[model samples]
Target chain A: MVKKKLIYLDNAATSFPKPEQVYQKMDHCMRNIGANPGRSGHRMAIKADEMVYNTRETIKKLFNISNSENIIFTSNATIALNLGIKGVLQKGDEVISSSIEHNSVFRPLMQLIKKGVRVKFIPCSEDGFLDPDDVEKAVTDKTKLIIVNHASNVTGNITPIKEIGKIAKRSGAIFFIDAAQTAGNISIDVKRDYIDMLACSGHKSLLGPQGTGILYVRPGIELNTIIEGGTGSSSESENQPELLPDKLESGTLNTVGIVGLGAGVDFILKTGLDKIRNRKVFLTIKLLKGLENLNGIKIYGPGDAGKIVPIVSFNINSIDPSEVGYLLDERFGIMTRVGLHCSPLAHKTIGSFPKGTVRVSLGYFNTEGDIDYLINSLKNILKTKA
Target chain B: MDKELKEECILVFQTTHRTLQAENILKKEKIKIKIVLKPRSITTDCGLAIRFNAEDKDVIFKIIKNNNLSLMGVYSRSGEKWIKL
Candidate 1:
């Protein structure tokens, strides 16, 4: 029996089949430089340390960050969000976040709410687009931070972050962007956009393995350390070092995963983000058009296809989303995400509340043929149901 | 026989990783450089520094500035003594 081909359409969750360079660099790190970084003076340890720093430099260049030390690595975007949210907010401080935030940002802010941090949710339309004017109106004297995701993971709608950033800056609020869905796929400059803090997952758009993420803090933005321990620097002092990265990053790091992330960033740099974005957009447009032509389908988000990421969420008439997801996987050998996608607030915002959507998120590796296959599979499923 | 005196400079960075980064940048510019253990005269941070020809100070400084390498300090070495440059 011939094995069926597997088509992965879940890049928004975690990108699959990372670049070849990422795999090679990760293997090389494991074989050659496998040691604790920043802890020892031995040759292998130094090599490991270089690997970590090299990744930081690569990330800096990619994000147009001035100080590489401001970028701190974490296990995932959730941890990074926790650090950013918990580190900055104090009692009686107000935070403005969009309704389309992932659970990673939502859960942390909820915890802060229990501690007296007031959070105001800027409403998004059914298309998952937030208004910058609403953000401006939401600001108050107590507003300490404005957090928004660059794009919605469920609907793929790109938020107007630059405009919101300007509003936050003029209001003297620190702007924090969750770029888990936009990093590597969108061009973001911390200085030009007036972003004070950014949190992103290395596994999503960055194409690195899971368990890697980044948080960038702008200069002079003092965030109290949430997790503190051995940073491999200032060993003599029991207190945590008062530096940028060492202050944010404590304990041993994931050296091999970081090396892989560096390679992934290098690939993005060499290939150019514009080219990658264009490719993903092309695939997304093709998928959207195909889905639009299909019968009994309800598509969500800014359906224009040109105004979003490569993610598309929809539900077929009278068909449960989980059933569609199951059929897509079991019969068609296509992988996709179904239901709330860990962003129940987003689902509710888009009016997909009780039941969710079947999300088909594309990546650079997905081909036009793959989109055609998905469309045909959906058409077949609809025919069977009819 | 007279011994020839040579002037050398050491670029100290906060971490060995940064010292290695400086080494890479200088090498790419074709400046003569080497990774040396942090000299005893200087305060030890990460136990590493980059040694290069003092005559290439202008070029090396340009490289450091251009790359934004986190350099702790620069020191010059004379006969049996190290002086801050």
Candidate 2:
């Protein structure tokens, strides 16, 4: 029995084959510095504490955050988004979000709606492009927050976040960006972009292991603490500490996962973000061009390759997306995602609701050869259907 | 032996994070410091403290002030007796 080569195109879900340094650092941390950080005075514990702080500092540099303490680690981006959204909004607050938001932001905002908070969505074009003017028009004096997904996970369409950020600033509404799909794939400056709060998944674009995520809160944003417990500081006090990270971060952190995330950030810094983005864009263009000529295939998103992340969504005429997904995997040993991609709002906006579309999300590790193989496999699947 | 240990002082912090941070800042400034278990005579808010030459007290204070570390207290040890400086 021979094993077929695996081509992973599900990076938008969670990155695979993380950089070698991520694995190495995780292993080293577990073996050498496994002590619970901020809890003990032992050398191992201190080392663990340092590693966590170093990761925060790395995140600060990567995101252009001025203060390291503003970055909080969570289990994943969903948890981070919950913290960002729920912590800031109060009753009667009006929140504006883009049409293309993952369940991470959408579900949280839905929960907020039940709490008497009003939520409005800025509509995007069929190609998932969001006009900054729509976002500006949606802003009201009662609009306390404006949340935008930096990029669409399903269609890979990049939103005009800087323009929206400016509108949010001028309107005096706090701007929160969901960078789950864009953190490492593109450049984001929390300061220059006027982002007051940002959430991201370390496991996805950051190239870290699962169970790692980040939330950046700008200074002077007095967010209510959502989850409260022992922060390993102010143990004498019965209340949580009133400090930057200690105020937001409670309980013991994921030290091993954080160290790995730090290593992943280090790798990104060393390799350079522009180089990674260029390669991913080139491969996506190649894939899009290859599939453009195929019959019965309708590609989704902006279709301009460079305007989006390295993700492509499309469908075969009259065929269920899941069926196409299954055939792509079993027949060709290629892995891709199907269905709504966890953003039903995006699907409905793009007219792929209910059935959804076949999505191929490329990563920095994927090559032109991989794109060619995916195109050829897609062609073979289409031929069989005919 | 008692006099030799008495020449040093321990700077205790409220949290292990701050204790480690203080050590890093002091080390970078070339100030000799050692992370030691908090002396039993000192209040144990955090289990660790920075031990350095008592003569370097002013320089240590400057470093802590520059870094804005939240220190619990500073105490000098003399033959097991902890004296608040």
Candidate 3:
């Protein structure tokens, strides 16, 4: 009996198969040293703690962080965003953001808007690009932090982080980056980029297990804790351990995930992140060029080759994103994500909110053949959309 | 044998071990590379290295050479481990 193959184009959500090495590493950790990290003097516990520490150290190197201890572990990008938004933001402070932010970022900050903090969002162009000049004009004295996604999960548009960081620096507002979409895909140096606090999801581009994330807190910027609890160190004190990681990490922490994350960062350092990013850009440009020929397919984001990652968001004319998603799922067996993609404001900026765009996000393993198949599938789907 | 094996620590990597990477193999797999860590000698440049593995030396060097990449260093487990001639 022959079997129908599954074409996975939904890479922006979570990576697939996990490069074999990732799976093996996670399994080895779960099997060998499944001990509570930072708890005991035992060898297993020590090893586990070392694994988490080493992971933080690796992340420090990956993003060119000034200090290893400054990197903190969180549940995911959402949690990190909440922590950054909630911790540093006092009521009545102002924030400046781009329209192209995941709701994970927008919602938290938006929640504080009603509580006295003024929030201003810089609009993206129809093609999903944010302008630095527009950001410059939007800045006000009350603006405490300028939060924006490094790259859009929906449209793959990369904001001019450096230019905006400069604006924030001049205005005395801290720059917080949602590196959820760009962390492993693009090159980001906290020092060079002038980002004060950057949130990253380990599972997406870094190929780590779910529940693993990183928050790079630049030195001299202290974010108060949203959750306070035991940090293996400073047991005598009732206060959350005042140290960097302990202050950020409130509980037992995801040790196995962090161990895997260490390996993930090590992998990126070995492979050279620029090399990985170029391959995705190559495939994405190819996809864009093909979509240009097909009728009824509307592409979003700036058409510039180097402006984004492998993620693409588009839709067929008059076709609901749910219908498109179902057809790709049930008929074509090509797994693609559709709808608002948890970033309704971004969709609204691109004018695809209520019924959103079908997004195909590529990764390191995605090849030209995969792009071709996706293009062909969309073409076929378009022709049959009676 | 035990001491030598302990000295030669495996530098676990995410990508293929053959690929040129940031981590290094410490010289003298059994002993930590003390010279690299002289007091006040670290210039914010100290990085991780496994106790050196001799066999991995040539391949790693060749990768850097072929890729036109420069690395920090390479070595093998040493309590009298042979150096490349």
The runs of at least 3 residues in candidate 1 whose Cα sits more than 4 Å from the true structure, single-residue gaps closed, are: A1-3, B1-11, B16-21, B28-32, B36-47, B51-85
Winning candidate number (lDDT) = 1
Query: Between 1 and 2, whose TM-score is larger?
Result: 2
Question: How many pairs collide in each candidate, listed in order?
Answer: 0, 0, 5
lDDT tens digits, residues A260-333, model 2? Answer: 99998889989999999998988988988998988888998989888999989999888999999999899888
Candidate 3 lDDT, A85-121, residue by residue in tens: 8988888898898899899988887788878888888
Write model 3 residue lDDT over B1-85, tens digit each, in one string: 3344443423322111111123322221222222111111211211222333445555645644664433333433335452222
Please give the range of 10 consecutive residues that has the lowest summed lDDT in model 1 chain A.
A230-239
> Which residue runs of candidate 2 sit more than 4 Å off their true CA positions?
A1-3, B1-6, B10-19, B36-49, B64-85
Query: Which residue pairs show collisions in model 3?
Result: B7-B29, B7-B30, B28-B78, B29-B77, B29-B78
Q: Chain A alone, TM-score for each of the models? A: 0.99, 0.98, 0.97
- Kindly list the per-residue Cα lDDT of model 1 for residues A37-59, writing each as its tens digit: 77766767777877898899999
**Tens-place lDDT digits, model 2, residues B1-85:** 2344448788988655567668878989988788777765565344578888888899989988988888889998777698998
True-contact fraction per candidate equals 0.09, 0.32, 0.00
Better of 1 and 3 by TM-score: 1
Off by over 4 Å in 3: B1-85
- Evaluated on CA atoms against the true complex, candidate 2 attains a DockQ of 0.39
